[model samples]
Target: MTASDDEKKMLRASLQSMTGALESVKMSKANTKPRVCLYEVIATARDGLLRRTKLSSDIRKEEGHRRDLNHAVKDANVNVKCKQQLAFNNQDPAQQDAIANDVENAKEEVITKQLEADAQKERVSSLYLERDDFNNALSRMLDATSIVMPFVNLGEIDDDMLQVGITAQSTFMQFCEDWERR
Candidate 1:
């Protein structure tokens, strides 16, 4: 189905918003230096990663919903066709009329299912695009953070510092794995 003007406008607006957010993240990462607090930088990057993860999850859900809708539409179409065939073959006039009505209803159901599937497909596509944009931005931020984090002076080494470093390393590894999975 063709997108309406309003739908197009909404899509454009969403894309623009994602683009702006990604640009902001990129700018922040680019401006990062060794003098910047590693914790704060990591926190910001972690937030972006979380957002990207959430968007990816949403995209997955939308894809599943779209698949279900497509199956429903296919089933509805098959039912309509089967009913139409039955209606034509029936010898009794009354039975034929009843079957014809059933076929009409099935046709209407197919139309409804098709519309729903189309809308769901559109949503899934939009979500995938948004997720990709966020993922790219997050990946850049993570890369920048990794490069700058090691150089940042965190004062004299202590047990607390060691623990923090270990935690950060673990989290970063998990983030990398998650990105790779996607």
Candidate 2:
């Protein structure tokens, strides 16, 4: 019914969309066929990465807007408090009523803005979590592909080769985790 309510609905929709996208990427990783070409795998990973990047950008933008709205809410609260105090100390009944009305209106506006900002924050947080999930899935796919594709291409389907691939994948994943920490 209200603008804030509409904004909350939009935020929920965005979060659902992002979650679905991440789930799709996870499905793709799970269903990857050994016979699939390396190029296609790379392209799929690239697409996931690009989507994650876009989500990150959107989260940043929403964070900025949320911060601005929070500031506005604070200003509005201050204005309402000032008006209320003035009304309380006023001598004229008419002037006091007018100031009280202004304070009430400001309070309503602050509540609406606060609700919008909170919804934006929720959306941003959801996007960040989804982006992280997508990134992790993509990294695992790339790491596995890097280690396994070589042996697969060489037609070396043996226990020794599988062991080597697993070792390489572990080492590569560890290196990546360390690099991220730095």
Candidate 3:
């Protein structure tokens, strides 16, 4: 039982009208403003914090090692002085020569330990600079994202706000892509 031509045309007109109405409603519901990629920003912050923590630990260990090396240098210097005093008191040529050799070896040890301490100090300084950089980078990211609501915490945000933010972000990205295509 096929419909008459007039009836088919009316049905087609009705369907087209309904489709237009639906399209209008969908367009009305579209987001107008852009959203921030909150998830990505959080991930970046977390990574930076982890790296900063590791760098802090490294700095502490390096500083401790440097202090130990400094103490070793001091002890070596004292040993050299003691050997020199002993050589000064001894009259025997052979004993004096042996003490002189001991003093020279102790002096060499002091120099080696001092060099190691200096290197460790340099490493600690570098780590401090690296950690500072990470801190500055994290601060810049937060500033750029406008996430600096001092009293507001991310965990306190409701699920609906998060969903809306994500949707807005997606819409904003699409808009950018579309604009670029032109």
In the range 9-125, model 2's lDDT, one tens digit per residue, is 999999999999999887565434333444455566566567667778888888898899889889989988898889889999889888988989999998998998898889888
Model 1, 53-165: lDDT tens digits are 78878888888888999999999999998998898788999899889889999999999999999999888887777677656656665665565455444433344444454
Query: Which scores greater on lDDT, model 1 or model 2?
Result: 1
TM-score computed on alpha carbons, candidate 3: 0.62
Q: On residues 1-182, what C-alpha lDDT tens digit does candidate 3 reach at each position?
A: 99999999999999999999998776444321122346554555566567668778888988898899889988998998898999999999999888889989889998898898899889889778766765665556555434432212333334455554454444444543553354
Off by over 4 Å in 3: 1-36, 146-182
Worst 10 residues of 3 by lDDT: 28-37
Model 1 gets an lDDT of 0.72
User: Please, what is the TM-score per model?
Assistant: 0.61, 0.61, 0.62
